[model samples]
Every structure is written in C-alpha cells, then in structure tokens.
Target: MALYEFRCRECGSTFEVDRPMQRSSDPADCPDGHSDTVKLLSTVGLGGRARTATRPVRPPSPFSGGGPPPMGGGGGGCCGGGGCG
Candidate 1:
C-alpha cells in the first residue's frame, strides 16, 4: 500500500489517502465530498542515508577527552561555542 496527499481545489482542503500502489493515481474526494482535487507532491523518506544538513555524524574529538563532541562551525557565533549544537 502507498500513501498519497491531495489538495482540494474547490474547497482548498488537504487530505491523505492510504490505498494500493496500483490505484494511487486514482482521483480522490475531499472530506467535504469535493471532487475538484489535485494530487500534491509529497516528500518521501526512504529510511536510509545519513542527513548531513542539520545533524551530521562525525568522529569524537580527541581534545574534549570523552566529553561532548566538537562543534562544527567557523568559530563565529552560536554554533561556534557549541551552544546551538
């Protein structure tokens, strides 16, 4: 089964559908019974790969002596002192 998101053009309501993968492209009705709906582009997480944007994994630093890991920044501001880390 696959999940899809749809937005109603008539009433402007967004909803989700959990149906079979083959019938995922079928038209969907809104909760208020509106037919003029369009499927939305949804973001899918494949449950793999490490995220290097917000939380990147790195090896423990040798200077901290088993304390918190070193922060990654240009030594400028909040993220520099590891406050926002």
Candidate 2:
C-alpha cells in the first residue's frame, strides 16, 4: 500500500489516503464528504534507510598532492648547485 496526498477543491483542505498502488489514480472524496479532490505529487520518503546498487568511484584529483609546485627554479642539490665534480 502507498500513501497518497490529496487536496479538496471545494473546502481547500488537504488529506492523505493509504491505498493500493493500482488504485492510486482513483478519485478520492474529502473528509467533509466533498467529491472534488485532486491527488498531489508527493516526494517519496525512504525513512533514511535507502541503499544503492553499487558505490560510485570518484576520479582522482590532480591537486591531491597538496597545492601547486615550487615557486622559482633552483633544483634540489647535486649538479643543480654545482656541487658535483
């Protein structure tokens, strides 16, 4: 059974009805005996227990190694500083 929300055009009142999914489109009468009620589009509630079929894998970010590279030139030691002979 599915819970459906409906609004009465005659009394401008809103109410909910629990019925079978096959009869979801069937006309529903308001609590005040008014026959002018229209079903409303409701958001589905999963009660915070929704699960997915598979987990999505996120692409690796280019800046994952911290920030940008070094500022000026100057390599790391060795022949960069003319220390090799």
Strongest candidate by TM-score: 2
Local accuracy of candidate 1 as per-residue lDDT tens digits, 1-85: 8889999999998999999989978999999999999998876734566667787668655543454545663333444453564
Query: What is the Å distance of residue 18 in model 2 from its true position?
Result: 0.2
Structure candidate 2, residue pairs in collision: none
**TM-scores of the models, in the order given:** 0.53, 0.57
lDDT of 2 by residue, 1-85 (tens): 9999999999999999999999999999999999999999886743665679898977544345333333564333434432467
Ten residues in sequence with the least summed lDDT for candidate 2: 61-70
Candidate 1 root-mean-square deviation in Å = 11.4
Q: For all candidates, what are the clash counts? A: 0, 0
Single out the weakest 10-residue window by summed lDDT for candidate 1.
73-82
- What does candidate 2 score in Cα RMSD to the true structure? 8.7
